[model samples]
Target: MSRAAIVVAAVACAACSGRMPVLDPGGPQAARIATYWWIVFWLSALILAAVVAFLLHTLAHRRVAAAPASLVEDTRVERRLALGVAAAVGLTALTLVVLLVTSVATGRALRSFGGTDPLTLEVTGYQWWWDVEYWDPVPSQRVRTANEIHIPVGRPVLVKTRSLDVIHSFWVPGLHGKKDNIPGHGSSLVLQADRAGTFIGRCAEFCGVQHAHMQLLVIADQPEVFDAWLQAQRRSAVVPTDAFARHGFDLFMTGPCALCHTVLGTPAGGRRGPDLTHLASRRTLAAGTLPNTVGHLAGWIIDPQAQKPGAQMPGNAFGADDLSALLAFLGGLS
Candidate 1:
C-alpha cells in the first residue's frame, strides 16, 4: 500500500477503537476537569503564539551591524525595558491566581457530596482486579460484584476506596478524577453520570505486572434498570436442573475451584477470587482480560496463566466432559 493509504488505515483503526475516556466527559466531574484542561491549553497556546510572533518580528527586522553603545544603554530604553518586565511579571501572577482559584473551585465541586442520600459503594483494589461492594442500609440490599460497577443515572454515588495490597488508583476518567487507594487509609470520591452509558475504568497506578489489564466497566443505567441489576446480583446462584449442569455444579463444589471462588446460596463460599454468583452477567472475565464467552470461559478454566501472566488463578486440568458440563453450569449463572 502507498504511504497515504497506510496513514488512512491507521487513522481508521484508531477511530474504530473508541475514544479515550479523558476526552469524553460523561459526567459533571469529568467536564469540570476538561474545562481546566482547556483553560491551560489556550493559555499555553497564546504564550507560544506571542513568542513566535516576537521571534519572527526580530528576524524580519535584523540589524545589519551592531548598535552604538550609547543607544544600547539609553535611559529611556532602560526605563521602558524595566516597565515591560514588571508588567509581564504582574500579568503572569494574575494568570496564576486565576488558574489557582479556578482549580480550587473545581476541586471543591468534585468533592461536594450534597444530594438526596447518595448510593454508597466500597471499592477495594486488589493485585490486578477490583472488588466492589454496594453498600445499603438494609443488609439484604448489599451486593458484591467484581470488575464492574452499575449505577443509576442522574444520581450521586459516593465511592469509598481502599487497597487490599499495594497502592492503586481508582479512576473512571469519563466520570471523575483519579483517587488513590492506599492501604490503611480511606479515601472517597463522588460520581454522577448525566447520561446512561458504559464507561471504561482502569487502575491509574502501576501496582504489578498485569497493571495494564486491570480494568473495570461502569454501567450507568436508569433507576429501574439499576435496581433490577442490583437485585439480581444480590441473589444467589441458581441451582441447575439439567443433568449436565447438575453434574457440573457437583464437580465445581467438590473440585479445587470451590476453594477460591464463591457461588452464593451454595456451600462453595470461597473469598479469594471474584464472586461467581452472576458470573455470566459480566461482560468480561479475569478483569477484562477476555470476553466472558463459553469458549473463553473454558479456556480460562483450563489455563488462566496463559491468558493473564501474573494472575492469581492457577490452571485446572479437566476432562472434556467435565469442562463442557462446567461451562454449562457457569453459563446459567445469570
Candidate 2:
C-alpha cells in the first residue's frame, strides 16, 4: 500500500481504539504473557542466526577444502559428525522443553486469582457490542452499562463472559489474553490494573461484518473514584424536567426507541440493544463505532447503516423538531 493510505489507516485505527501495544502490558497478567513472548522471540532469533551461520560456514569450508581422494571412509570423521548432530538435537529438545514449561506457567499464572474482594462483571458479547453487568450480591444494586467499563486500580476484576449470538472473544492486550465467549459455554478472565489509565479492548474473534467495529474501553480508576462511579450507575436515569426534554422522553417511550433500548426506572425497558440508562455517561456509542456526541448520535439515529453496516439498530426518519428533542433528552442521560 502507498504511504498515504497507510497513514490514513493508522489515523482511523487510532480514532477507533488508540494504539494497541501488546508488548507494552499494563497489568501483571499481561506482563507474564509479554515475558513469555520475549523468551520465545529471542530463542527463535538465536536458532535462525545459528542455522544461517552454519550454512555459510559449511559453504565456505567446502570451497576451501580439496576434494576427498577416492571417497575415503573415515570412522573418526563419521563419529564426530554423529556427535555434532546429537548435540544439535539435544539443544533443540531443551529449547522445546523450555517453551513448554513457560507456556504452562503463564497459563497457570493467568488463571490464578481468588482475591476476597475482587470485582465481578458479567460481560456478554453481542454481535457488535458488549453488555456489561456489574455483578452485585444484591440484585437491585447491580449496575448495567455498555462498552465503557471502569475497574478499581490495583484490584482484581473477575470477568465472566458469554456470547449472546455468534462466538466472540474478549481481549485487552494491555490487561490479559483473549478469552473466547462461546454461545453455550461461559469463560472467565481475571485482570488487574496496577495504575490508573484507560485500556482498549476488542472482540478478538470474527463474528460478523461489524466485528471490526466491536470495541470497548477499560477505564482503570482509583478505588474511591470507581466506587463513586458505580454508585452513580446504580441509580435510575433522571427524569427530564424541561418542556422539550419531557416531550422527548414521551416520544422515546412511545416510539421505536423503546423497543430495543432500555432506560432504567421507566417503562421503556427493552433488552435487544444496549441499555441507555447512562448513555451520555459513556465515552462512545454503538460499541465505539462513533464518538458519543450530539452530532454523531443524531447522525447515527438518522442513518445507522451509514455509520456501521449490518448494525442491529435501523435508521429513522423523524422530523427535525422531534430529532432535536430526542437529542436533548438522550444527551442528558448522564
Q: Largest lDDT belongs to which candidate?
A: 2
User: In each prediction, how many residue pairs overlap at the backbone (N, C-alpha, C within less than 3 A)?
Assistant: 0, 0
Candidate 1, residues 220-287: lDDT per residue as tens digits?
Answer: 99999998898889888889999999999999999998998888888888989888889999999988
Clashing pairs in 1: none
Question: Which ranges in model 2 have alpha carbons more than 4 Å from their true place?
Answer: 1-17, 64-67
Per-residue lDDT tens digits for candidate 2, residues 201-286, read 99999898888889999999999999999999999988889999998899999999999999998898899999999899999989
What value does the lDDT take at residue 129 in candidate 2? 95
Per-residue lDDT of 288 in model 2: 83
The numbered model that scores best in TM-score is: 2
Q: Which stretches of candidate 1 lie over 4 Å from their true place?
A: 1-18, 65-73
**Candidate 2 weakest ten by summed lDDT:** 10-19
